[model samples]
Target: MLPQDLITEILLRLPVKSLLRFKCVSKQWLSLISDTHFRHHHRHASSGVILCRRTDIIHHVSLAGSNSDYQPFTSLCFIDDSAGVKILQSSHGLLLCCSNYKLGKARSYYICNPSTKKYSILPEPDYVSVSDNSSVYLVFNPTKSLHYRVACVRMCSSSFNSYQVEIYSSETRDWRSSGSPFAAPFDMVFDSGVLWNAAIHRISPTGASLCFDINQERLGAMPGLPSNEKWSRRRLRYFGESGGRLHLIEIYGCSTQFQVFEMDMDYSSWVPRYNVDIAPVVDTFPEMLRNCIVRNDFVLYAFSLLCLQEDEDDSLLLLHIPGQFVSYSLRNRTFKVLNSISTESNNAFQIGCFHAYQFMETLADADQYL
Candidate 1:
């Protein structure tokens, strides 16, 4: 048998996706991979895959490892129709999804660790009466804490004295409502915010600049958008995080030109990283995108920059391209189209809204916490 030190040294180099599968190789291997130290090493050593979902099917592509990562999609669990499975957010390695349960045909929320294929439905949030269907988001950073956190904001103002925020904690396995809220309530759209630091930052066109701190359960304003580029209704905008910093991505409708911006932690200001204008890519796939835009469908929303994977020189552009998802490499400036199905048929293409999240594959023992 190999020495424990040598075994750990070699195992640390293995990609997380492979390590997850290797857990079944043996009890020893499974225990070692589940070790907290091993998980940290694996998370740091490997850049995990980017997960994008096309309705019921969730497609994942590696950030660095192999070029043949165009793997097929994995179908998530939904009670009746696959259409009921909706991914609210992905953090660490777990996906916070809501599905229509067959028990009572009621909407259920679950935290699923895609790596281990383990999931558990959460009990209803604390007795704080959630009347309106509030938009919810997941916050899970394994490096910070073992438990995951979720918060929901009622997009429309409530009749109550203040806009209440509901929170769920995996540690306690219960939900609670915030007692105090900023006088001004949030009114941003769902999927327009990102979890960064200990707070959730939201971008609004009305210049609300809202942020909800999970730890403190307080809402406040932050730095606004850049003064140069004005917000436009035609452009598609999204907020993301990379390297512990917040990012803003704006893609012009049906255009190959996309702009990226990075924000400071304190929400002080915004800085432009690079104006990615893939003229050749557009020139090549002109008809495809043009037809998509002409459809005037909501699924054709702009391609948002999910995560800027860690690469010394080259940057990976993980975009949420409608119908089909593609990755752009800054080094070669080339577009590699990704598909969810393995079959080589153009008819497999379908038009729908899909979310591409910056995912990191980790075996962080979801069942232990949930």
Candidate 2:
């Protein structure tokens, strides 16, 4: 047998399932498996998938790549049936689920490692307001640090004078004020901010703008959208992060196309990344999808995944269709249907609940943060 030190090294690099099984080899192994240091090492070994809840079931798919064979994937969700909002965000392999139930009368959030089925419910924040739109974001990366923090941002648009920032620290096991940094307003309805380069980039009600830095625990402004661009409400515009860079995606124009831009590391400029024409793409795919484009009234929602290292042609765009996920290649110009995602019913409301977020798998436990 290898020496215990050597075995520990090997175990740390093993897959989650194997590590969990190795716990049964002996009490010593079990203790090592549960050690904080071991979990940290294991987190570095595995990168997680985006978890999407389909009604009661959770489906986790690779952040990039097409489901050419229609292989199915499903993970059990421990969420209470009464839960609402169903917003899923990930940081350091842990998923932060912010939900509003009881008809906006109450708010509850959960942090869980879906791989291990270990979860912890967070105490309600002090600023739980009558407005259901309280802003929250997660900041945790095992590679960079062991600690995790959640930030809730509120803007006093009445004046560009200041914004309220509250932070929840795992070490403190409670939420505290990080103080007002700047005056900014985020249109939660249109802007789904993403954490990149240690800051939460949000936008104004007008469309592509940036604000909030959870790590800095303050609000701030960002450069304006690319010069001479018309941000029409007729089109759907959203922001996403992939491969360590932030992206702005605009889907509009009479051509029914998608315009994607990648932000520079310095956050000072934008570069055209991909220009996808959906009409030709629909002609190349299934009848149902083709009809979505031909009918002219069908709505499209997409979840962006990083450009996969293996697929050179393009970044993967996961189309949010009822009861299924369709992967569209930005470069190679291909489309594949994801059959692994199965819905219990075809109800439009239930289908609308299916939202996807990129999850980076890590061994970080929610308990350690507290």
Candidate 3:
């Protein structure tokens, strides 16, 4: 048998691609790599996105081993259909993809580990859209637990003009519904089992930004906004994570400047944090606006057109810039350009919306190997 020290040394150096494949070598290696402690070590050793751009293809990028020099990594493509993929949320190695076509009627949800090329399909959701509630909102946190539970909130008709929420536990693989005294069509964001439900009241052309919590399967309102009407009037956007904290990014519909607010540990209030801005002209890029994702320290905004000069193919040039990823530092109050991603081919299909989840890896024991 190889010495444990040697095993650790070798595994630590394996690229994420090799490591993903080795996960199935045995349950033991999977547990070691998936462990939170191990992930932190790897994260520091391997900074930057391990994944990017969802076209007819999906790509994974990793930092060169302990090297500061920029090393263009290998790209892996999953080209099944021209259908593009959107990453909703990610944890560990598994990615949840919501693949919908034709007005999202024949939508398909999948849990895939691109590294291993292994995927599982989730059964179609069956929630009756009865009464005034027109749509169902689903949020997932794969990092919450080993089994990766998917939580959902449904808008159902009620006599008192209130909305109802339903919870689903992937561990139990079941959905249970409950009623909330609150009203309908609220915006939602989730971290682990904690659900943030924000009321959407139209302010002129904008919406109100009041939020509530639904943890332990119970609902309650969050604290009030601190900024003046100017702040509240701005579009209240729910950004998944900012500087390692759950945050809400508030931006004026007509302005380039935006504010960031962190979720209070008490889950009772939103503490105003940082400010950011992009060139208003940047909004023209549809990709930048539509399917952006936030990482531990970066905010990725999509751009629509890529432009090239002279022999400039307008289409290629329009997509040339691909997308811009901005990494912000809360401590320094500064931003840095992270990287750019592009579609391998414009022939790639387009998606309206995507559902994402990152599997919260758990320690594996001899008895619990899958």
lDDT of 2 by residue, 1-370 (tens): 7798998888876766677788899999999988887876774323424445442455555534433332122443565536553645766567777564676456667777766766677776675441344567778777667888887665554566455667788877888777564544444431266788778777665754655666665555667666454554344355667667687765543444766788877667778777766565445444435334322544543332322321233467666443445666777666776555334423422433545566555566776566
lDDT of 3 by residue, 255-307 (tens): 54566676686657678765555453355445555566554444544432111
Off by over 4 Å in 1: 15-27, 44-56, 63-67, 70-73, 78-84, 101-104, 129-132, 155-162, 183-187, 227-234, 251-258, 288-313, 319-325, 330-352
Candidate 2: lDDT over CA atoms? 0.60
Give the TM-score of each candidate.
Answer: 0.79, 0.77, 0.57
Residue 132 C-alpha lDDT in model 1: 29
Please list the C-alpha lDDT of all candidates, in the order they appear.
0.63, 0.60, 0.42
Clashes of 3: 19
TM-score preference between candidates 2 and 3, better one: 2
Worst 10 residues of 2 by lDDT: 302-311
| Model 3 misplaced regions, further than 4 Å | 9-13, 20-54, 57-86, 91-93, 103-105, 125-144, 157-163, 178-182, 185-215, 230-238, 251-259, 275-326, 333-335, 339-370
Ranked candidates (lDDT, high to low): 1, 2, 3
